[model samples]
Target: MQYLNGKFQIGYSIRKNDEEFVYNNGFLYSYSDDPEGINEWHNYKGKKVSSLVDPYEIFFYEPADVVPGKVKITASPFWTVTKRGDIHFMMNNVEGSDKAKNVHSYKKASDSEFTHTTEFPGGELRSVGNDLYLISLENDRPVIRKAEGGTNDWTVM
Candidate 1:
């Protein structure tokens, strides 16, 4: 299976009694060489994962495997010193959601990237793209890279 642009791609092929499936960039393909075999596939793009299957059902490609579970939420202190030597610090958290309460603060580095730090429920500092940051929930996990892309230059700390 492969994913790109927030879409899932799958492909399948069958030869004799053997069937093969492959997913690439939000497209699903299936092939069966057996004269009497059934060829099946689905395109899951722009659809929520919960809509297709039960969230509790465990599959070979379970998304929950990559996400975290509930934990005590804590906030982190944010501090930033721009290239110009200006210093700034603050604590920021989302309003309304319980998950937001866990957020400590965010630090901006560029228009597309920044770093977020948190201590409640869990502890981790995530670097957002090139200049902005946001708090992530326990079950929230970034996919990191697109399938078509060769690789991501960003490092996970």
Candidate 2:
């Protein structure tokens, strides 16, 4: 133990081979060289426990201007909801490759379900200005199409 800058300094270490030393902004530190070697250096803060939310049964919130409420769905989301102005778009997971479909109906309270076709996961939902679109790989091929709808009705583009 030693005192530096009018503060008590202490050291604790384990034996490591690969990790030689650690250097900070202005101070150089030397750790105890134990017979056992260390391969990697890690800076740990503390142990913590946390809970994760399920992707399926995720909740979608409506725009404040249009509506002020939250909606939850039990469907396994493929990617995530892409926004197009006042509208949100995404694809729904299904049984097989051609079983999944595209969905876009989380804009306003008056918004209705707009399913297109059998889409798959790993797909992307995009929108240009007010136009929404979806692109995905089907049958080992890349497919791009426009989402044919606005705030309510949606169809295959």
Candidate topping TM-score:
2
List CA RMSD, all candidates: 18.3, 21.6
Instruction: List, residue by residue over 27-121, the lDDT tens digit for candidate 1.
Output: 11211222332332222122223222332211112111122433221232333333321212233332222334323222222222222334433
Q: Candidate 2, residues 1-157: lDDT per residue as tens digits?
A: 2232222222222222233211210111111122222322111111111211221112232111121222222243322222232334343432222332334333421344332323224356655545555677788888766643344333454
lDDT for each of the candidates?
A: 0.25, 0.31
With a 3 Å backbone cut-off (N, CA, C), the pairs that clash in candidate 2 are 16-38, 17-37, 17-38, 100-119, 146-157
| Worst lDDT 10-window in candidate 2 | 23-32
Backbone clashes, each candidate = 29, 5
Let me know the TM-score candidate 1 reaches against the reference structure: 0.18
Point out where model 1 deviates above 4 Å. 1-74, 93-139, 143-157
Superposed model 2: Cα runs more than 4 Å off: 1-84, 94-103, 108-122, 148-157
